[model samples]
Target: MDEDTTLLALSAIAHRSRLAIFRLLVAVGPRGLPAKEISAQLGIVPSSLSFHLKDMSRANLVSRSREGTFIYYSAALDAIHGAIDFLTENCLAGAAGNPSSR
Candidate 1:
């Protein structure tokens, strides 16, 4: 990911609720969960979850799809990995035995 995209993804996850949402999604895996289930599981108000989900979608941190009448959301894995890669791209570049590398 480019600097701007990475920044957007990082900023999107910076919020407490958003981070919780992202972590929950990651734990749930790519099959994802319905909007109602997410809100219930996280104890987030439906309206608030909707807003956070929208922001995350804009940042490419999450994706959604409609099936029947429900909207299922999942982490944008490619973007997640990209953002992580951007952060640690050069960590311990030549420190072969660095503990931090592990």
Candidate 2:
């Protein structure tokens, strides 16, 4: 991921609610969860949840699908992996004398 994309993804989860939502979505796996359930679990209002979901969507952190009248949200693993790769690009653990290497 580029710096701009990385920044957006990082900012999307930089809030209390957003972080919780992301974690919940990941926990539930790609099957995802509906908006109402997410709100109930996180104790966030519908309006706020909607806002956070939109932000995550824009950042490619979460994906939404309409199943019947409810919208299901799932964590976007590709984006998450990209963010992790970008953040750890400079950390070469296998390099000789690397402190991070076991």
TM-scores vs. true structure, each candidate: 0.85, 0.87
- Expressed as tens digits, the lDDT of each residue in 30-100 for candidate 1 is 88899899999999999999999999999999999889999899999898799888877744355576777
Give candidate 2's error at residue 97 in angstroms. Answer: 4.9
Name every residue pair that clashes in candidate 2: none
For each candidate, the alpha-carbon lDDT, in order, equals: 0.90, 0.91
Which 10 consecutive positions of candidate 2 have the poorest summed lDDT? 90-99
Model 1: which ten-residue window has the lowest total lDDT? Answer: 88-97
Q: What is the lDDT of residue 69 in candidate 1?
A: 97
Model 1 TM-score is: 0.85
The positional error of residue 12 in candidate 1, measured at the CA in angstroms, is 0.2
What's the C-alpha lDDT at position 46 in model 2?
97
After superposition on all C-alphas, the RMSD of every candidate to the true structure, in Å, is: 3.0, 2.8
